[model samples]
Target chain A: MTVMTTAPDKRDNAPILSVRDLKVHFPIPGKGLFAKDRPLKAVDGVDFDLYPGETLGVVGESGCGKSTLGRAILQLIAPSGGQVAWLGKNIVGIPHRDMQPLRRDLQIIFQDPLASLNPRMTIGEIIAEPLVTHKPELGKDEIKTRVKRMMARVGLLPQMINRYPHEFSGGQCQRIGIARAMILEPKLIVCDEPVSALDVSIQAQIVNLLQELQREFDLSLIFISHDLSIVRHICHRIMVLYLGNVMELADRDSIYANPKHPYTKALISAVPIPDPEIERNKERIVLTGDLPSPLSPPSGCVFRTRCPFAQEKCATDVPTIDRVSETQEVACHFHNSI
Target chain B: MMNKSEKTALLQSASAAKEIEGRSLWRDARIRLFRNKAAVGSMIILGIITLLAIIAPLLSPYAYDQIDWGYIQEGPNWENGHIFGTDGNGRDLFIRVLYGARVSLAVGLLATAVSLIIGVTYGAIAGYFGGKIDSIMMRFVDVLYSLPFMFFVIMLMVVFGRNIFLIFVALGAVEWLTMARIVRGQTLSLRRREFIEAAHATGVSNFKIIFRHVIPNVLGPVIVYMTLTIPQVILTESFLSFLGLGVQEPLTSWGVLISEGAKVIEASTWMLIYPAVFLALTLFCFNFIGDGLRDALDPKDR
Candidate 1:
């Protein structure tokens, strides 16, 4: 009953969250008064619609703004530009005081689980904090009962409530983080590499627990991670990002079976196959140059610097996202030929 | 019925386990502090000194300010019951030194408490908020920092009139600047920490985050600074008293005793020796305690 439901059949219903052309450009500090200010475009012009209960995996390499995009979506880091609409209401540029009531439905889980939990606070206090903030009317006994129950659901012993975060192991700490996020019963949770810090075996457990919770709560998730294999396992739709731009957006099966973008193709191929025979025979496309500096990105296609099939035209013309199929979108000028 | 009994038994055992106090970071630091011989020894010595200061009036027969012209400039002689002997004015140095301890210790503790309150709140807010608010707040700190230490204290004394409480307010106001700077620097690094970010994401108000999250995390350094600040505040008070801007004549401080002792040191050296020894011992104890706290509270060392 807790198994992940991968169906994208909920298109008939309205999207719970809509992010249109979201941009988070961080301005660099200039040396002198006359010096031109350079802005690092962390999440450049990202657009996505998340239906209820759908998980959108944002895949990228290190420093590709996957985490920034996730944070921007939840308004943890304010968006420099664009609209983040929650139930057709624009949440961008809203004062934090106003954002408080809306935050009950929007939550986040961090990458480093242990780092996310405060060292001074006990597990009970940490989990109960959200409840204490949002639901002031709740009795102390009621909050404790809810926290203890949430702790149990997240696989942490309720008896360990008085223990500090440092007393718990990494996996248990992550459970505490999950318990805190879940206590609010948030409608949309931006899971920013939730299981990346855990061991492979532990990652499966955390991922499984997330799926179970999602099903139970009917929650939508924006799962951000660099690991494609884990993203493929849980995410219903995957969005491939490179240097703060989406290279491809496709359904999970379509992304794995037939990735259209050159960057996505390289990324998918890099994932190690389980079987030795297939792994040895599979062709690998290893791009040569390092990730271009986002400070001064390439003029046209951001990927053209490290692209395998780059041409003169690739440098001169920026490629807009083209709908190649009903389930897939590729951002490459020569995607059809290639 | 069996399940109910088992659940109760489990809860009872858990409660019993909880009786052994949880080993928090503060508790861990305390254990480490006791393990350091110098710190624990200093603590005992400081405790003795404080006790003596508190009960000085009860212990001594002669009043702190009583003049005995019969035994003027007398050396350490128990025959007259002045163990530390008498000064030029024939005032018993023993009673004077104990009374001095009272003033010095009071100034040290009260002034440090004042600084801690102002510095921690000001620094934590500046660091947590950042941006334009941080710039403006820190600039104000910088402006305050530029004032000459002696000049500022002298001005404050002139304006507020000379009193022990005024001295406390003056020293605290001056010293809290450095503390605020230290706290602000600490808070800057802590600002980027994931827990602070987590708190923000959890919809905690900025004010609440500063108090509950930021202030507690910065306390290790703040506490260590506080221990060190006590000694500094004591010395500053002594310097002020030496200049005759501090405590008035009837109520003498270590500085007053030392200043009077310096004037007559050629004739009677114990007058200088006794008060000097007490002041030095107290400063040393505070320094050692501060060192111990730094070692204990430092997470890197752990």
Candidate 2:
């Protein structure tokens, strides 16, 4: 059912998408009133591997380069440096015209559903637009029939095809989004906090829909979210990013059960346990202060300022992703000790 | 203010009838605009002007520029087919005024369209790109924007030959600078919306994103600006035509007609009164349409 079901060696096997030394920077206004050169390093040297039929969730606080990483891999925001090879094609610095065919291969589900759908267009038109634009050879009647089928597939009424984005609820809007993404039968989809914009009940429904659809459509997903528990539920492997760099990357159970990096430990421990007695028992690992500006990140480890395990080496040379074992990777001098 | 019980009853009625179905945004806006008596009345006035403008050539028997000594300085009567009477040079005022509508409408529509096209594209690109591209392009706009429009347009007239197409193109080119600036601001703001990024993510090119996503959202402002621009173009054409720098004698405009009418104002009042009233009415109708558009496109007006 997956993109590569022919091969059984999936997650622990060869990577379908390999991102190495990926960097994305946004030039910020410096001393000069009209300065041009400098930029903020939004995603700096982040590395990961995503295999077939697997959800690789990247969890981080806001502006920690998680979103930037997802966008960069999809070539949504052009990366400053490094390689992002998707199905063996390095799409870094790809031209807009060249990226069109590549777009159908990989799609992105945005965070805000209300703003994602075009307000002026009907539901059918919004979904059919991409198909018609991408495949102009496909006739009008075929496009209409496909759109109608997709709407029904996404749980929207046949009559509601003519309705606008404003007419739909948040949950319905997200269903429309899912419909749009799967219509092309993309190989991989980068979900930018797909459930973050919906209500609590709606979140579970959407998460279940994503799971069901993933099985039905056989999708490879890059799930980007701030919620650790949701990531724990959906992802096969999880990468913890902090200040434009990956702090930890491992299997969901291993990362949750044995959090190596101090930053990961802090993130995991912060999740409120539902049971009152258990919640009262577990110590809350709170990190210090706010996230540092990506424009002028710390010299050694990006998280040194807030990291409780910081020592002399933590302030000097930055630690690379050291393989502690066959399955886990951590970027910290005292990761083992912490 | 209503009584507490009445207010509660009204609230309950509204809440119970929260059926937001089978209603379109455009349909609702049209209804609201139609309810405004002033805007509707102006529509009627505009209709009359359009009809008059269209049939001006067929109704008038006299050639607009034909000079006749026998009918020179003639007054309104059945003689000599001088319906609205003759001007100082014995030319038919009625014929000339009718012919002027074609000129006024031509200048209005043509100049306005050219400006809108240039301005909208320029603004969308500048705003959507943001950062350095936005800053540099906007700065270029700011420099040109500081100059007085009439002064710049007049200079254009002096430089270019007094041809109708040249005048329209020049006016359009100069006026579009304003529209481009306005559109850029709107695009810049729209770029921040999630849909733009979603389009970008779906590998929709910058050009498609601008046209599909940004343009449709920013169309309200552009439409309002276009409506406003038409009246201004008409006025500008009239002024230049009055100074004998715009539409020539054989092809008359409101400005040329008004200028000729003003010369013999002391002797004949109908000449000045008719043209002035029509000009005022044309400008008024455009403004009303602009106001109606402003209200219609505004989402909060619901």
User: Which candidate number would show the highest TM-score if scored against the true structure?
Assistant: 1
Tell me the TM-score for chain B of model 1: 0.92
Please give, for residues B176-278, the per-residue lDDT of candidate 1 as tens digits: 8888989999999989888887777778888888888888889999999999999898888888888898899888999888888898889889989999999
**lDDT values of the candidates?**
0.89, 0.82
Residue-wise C-alpha lDDT for candidate 2, range B100-209, written one tens digit per residue: 88889889999999998888988899998888998998898888878886676677777875678878887897788989988988887888787777677666778888
Tell me the docking grade of candidate 2: acceptable
Chain A of model 1 scored by TM-score: 0.97
DockQ of 2: 0.24
Q: What TM-score, to 2 decimals, does candidate 1 have?
A: 0.95
Q: Largest lDDT belongs to which candidate?
A: 1
Query: Which 10-residue window of candidate 1 chain A scores lowest in summed lDDT?
Result: A1-10
Q: Highest DockQ among the candidates is held by which one?
A: 1
lDDT of 1 by residue, A1-338 (tens): 13455765776999999989999999997789889889998888988889999999999999999999988887888899999999999999998778889988888898899899888888898999999999989999999889987987777767787888888888889889999999999999999999989998889878988988998999899999988888888999999999999999999989899989999999999999999999999999998888888888899999999998999999999899999888899999988888
Cα error of candidate 1 at position A272, Å: 0.4
Off by over 4 Å in 1: A1-5, B1-21
